[model samples]
Target: MSPTMTEQIVLTAREARDVPHGEKGKFYERASERLGISTATLRRGIRSAAPSKERRRRSDSGRYALSREEALLISATILHAQTRDGKRIKTLKDAVRMLREKGAILAARIDKDTGEILGDLSDGAIARAMRGYHAHPDQILAPDPVTELRSNHPNHVWQVDASVCRLWYLEDGLQAIKRDAHYKNKPKNLERADRFKVTRYVVTDHYSGWVYARYVRGAESGENLCAVLIDAMQNRGDRDILRGVPEILMMDKGSANTAGMTKNLCQALDIRVFPHEKGNPRANGQVENGNNLVETTFESDLRFYTVRDLSHLNKLARMWRIRFNAERLHSRHGRTRSMAWLDIRQEELTNAPSAAACRNLATSTTVKRIVSSVLRVRLGGREYDVSQVPGVLVKGPLDVAYDAWGDEHIKVVRTGKDGRPVHYMAPLAKRGAGGFFEGAALIGEEYKRKKDTPAQTARAEIEEMITGERTKRGAEKARKEKRLPFGGTIDPFRGMSEKDARPYQVPTGRDHPAIAPTVESPRLTPTRLAMLLRDRLGRDWPEDGYQRIVARYPDGAPEESIPEVMAAVTGKKATPDLRVVKA
Candidate 1:
């Protein structure tokens, strides 16, 4: 008959407390198994509910007391067996044997009658217990090698990796903050703490040569790898530049890349994974080259103490990547990364959904504010009012962009300029009823200056003012240097053929050197000298300078060494009348 619940509880407590002291440690496991409960639950319930003091049992002895390590080992054995393979090691005798195989020591009873181990313990028991814990051949999961992945545009396959760097944290000015009651800066002398372990993960576009890099504590962890990828995707200037989530990510079999949890996350996001052969890890050559380039830039030029913190190193990595892609020229692409990207992606970019639709929902965005309202925004310790117009605002960050035109002004907050987002009021005087085109010029300027200044209205106004001044100066110069109206008659040089353009004959020492009358006083100017020489020796005039000018009269021969020398020698001040030549 099955024991009642109360009776089972009583028996479990009795085993834990009244079992001979020499056997008390072993009783919990045996009693828990027999009573159909966990050792932990049984121990807890008995310790709390059972009578603490008991009459000394005759079998009580010190030899069987369970040490802490032994208890932990037994508990670990039970837990390990509780997994899918748990049921196979069901009996206490089996559990003890498994524990011994896992480096535990124990004794067992045997039956003299059938030569079988009694209560499930016997010779080779440890080996038998290990058999149940052994993993099946089919249980191992292997990585699948993907041979190919095709992409039509940028961001298709962003490769990531890590490297070490030494960084120096500036402290001189950082010290002032500690003294200032209002200052809340972190404690200084940070660079003195040497030896930072830096890891850099870079994502390079297969097509555009554009790359993004981040300094992480280590790229070996799934968390940091995921972070760098997300950072690259989110910070890109053009989000829709990607055709879709990358079709495949080519990576080596690094711990971070092949982590089960990370792999699962990638699957959930529909990112296919392709790992390179174990020994041959160069499948992602682009990003590896990117790391080298980063090293060249930082290791060669920028000196640092050590890349101690991941986030700080990442910030520096971002700055370096921006410079590498936007400003630095690459020999392979024969242009800047930005230029190459624009060359291949311009058409696709034009066709992408409007920037308004592409703004990420996650980040605090720039918003446009009118001049009538002063926006209260602070960044990096400075304060500014946003221009009242259509600007970008990162929701609650108090950052604002002013766009008096259609394209928002907040877009210009990228690096290279004042990286912080700008906030300025639109000038009321300039507000006019010009359609989107009227605003388009400002919009274009803002787009061009996105990586320049963060202040929306200030940048716009400065561009407009500078442009107006240049235009006015140009118009005044044009008006002052007047040109004659077109003449009704066309008689001479129109449609002249090459045959009509005879060689400019000039006097040589071999031909007419004696009769070629030299001018009493040479005209210093090229035009005057050429004419005087041509008239004196009509068929023997030097043709060098005159011939070049005559070929393209208005455009004129370039005022180079030949003309300058002729003018210097001739004493005449007249400019070169590049139109005339003697043949």
Candidate 2:
């Protein structure tokens, strides 16, 4: 035991004066007793009153032993060895063992009594080092220096996620649980759970902190998530103006964040997706904070509302979302969500995709599949005919970008002579395996499907002779007989003529197939200018390079026309053929 503060103070005074305190034995002993110390302790305390040297910590000494570089490597390995939920799958011992296996000799401490050595890289030491280094992520693993997340502008980025509601509601099956106290009810039936728990899917603008939420009765499912996202993409709420698709979306590694959904959503909306680091909620802090608000601001007052079903819960949630957007002030801008959203210029908010488009994208799935010899490709345990995307399902299996689940439209990524994406024939869904083949593109009169004439009947006979025979024998037999590339669809032409067939078109000149839509400019469109540029710059010039040249003249798109694209493409020697512009 150490001496009391009073004893230490008095002892210090005595030591400074060189007083003979121990000489008065009874007096010192009584003083020591009063101070909760012995006479010997009192004398030692006085002698130690003069400040002694400070003892250093073990970490300070060993800090230099493990170089910062090596410590970071070990720490990074441990960090990355975590699961999606952020649980460490690899232990410190495992990390050390791996380092040793890779010929990295680490420091160790020896047991004084047993003469055994233990590696110095303990879990606690690594954890402490990590905490120190997290303050400076620049020295460690980080996103590319050029790529950084921005949250100052609307549509810059948006974060989405789902969380379990903190409060429970009166579910249908179990009235007994709801009758008890908030903490009371515990049910043991399959139809019921601990009172009730609901999932809340939230979407928030990273810049404005505007939020949209949906409450569901069941677990966090992908279908429900898709529905909520579709709603957010299509509808503008009563008070909130946060409607358009974000330029980039941030999310965690939840099942709903699958590649199928991401690719379709991103492609359809022309947006980008940045999945949050595994188990790192801070990366998606905007929406995560919003989720907490869903619990605190709304769910906290659950007792006030007479909640009936998931619909009622969602109704209440929408009103809460409206209030959160219109009434609540944002910390960053000191403006309400609606104000921040409205502050953005109208031109910045482009066209919002229609509800039909949302449905199509939500159902679309992009899969890398090989087109079979029978002009068919297998996917999701079913084979689909590729007759419409490429008329007659030509031989090779190129990149197929299609959404078959809904409209079942397919677009074969076929390149042109300049090796650029060309709009090929838009093929309809083929029949078989619960499928159907529609018509092809209707860009021009030439693109229109040739009505079945005497020639087509003979051609169909020849097609059946080659495909039907081999298809019956199977794909292997079809492979042997390459005469008919693929078996024709059951209704070959979907049994429809130009008189009443559905309208589908690919807009491009026969000589130069356009990759994307023509720009709105009357004088110069990207597709139109690229054609002229390509003519001047040899046949081998890249299509994108020409497009870039057209884009460089900023006046053309959404502004005055600039013929700089032609001037830049055709050098001084070449004469400018000011071809008349047409849409």
Best by TM-score: 2
C-alpha lDDT values of all predictions: 0.49, 0.62
The TM-scores of all predictions, comma-separated, are 0.29, 0.45
Question: Can you tell me which runs of candidate 2 are displaced by over 4 Å?
Answer: 1-148, 173-191, 194-197, 259-262, 365-583
The sequence of per-residue lDDT tens digits that candidate 2 reaches over residues 280-320 is 76788778888888878887777665677777777788778
- Cα error, residue 92 of model 1, in Å, equals 64
Off by more than 4 A, model 1: 1-151, 166-196, 236-244, 304-310, 343-583
Report lDDT (Cα) of residue 237, candidate 1: 48
Local distance difference test, candidate 2:
0.62
- Cα RMSDs of all predictions? 34.2, 32.9
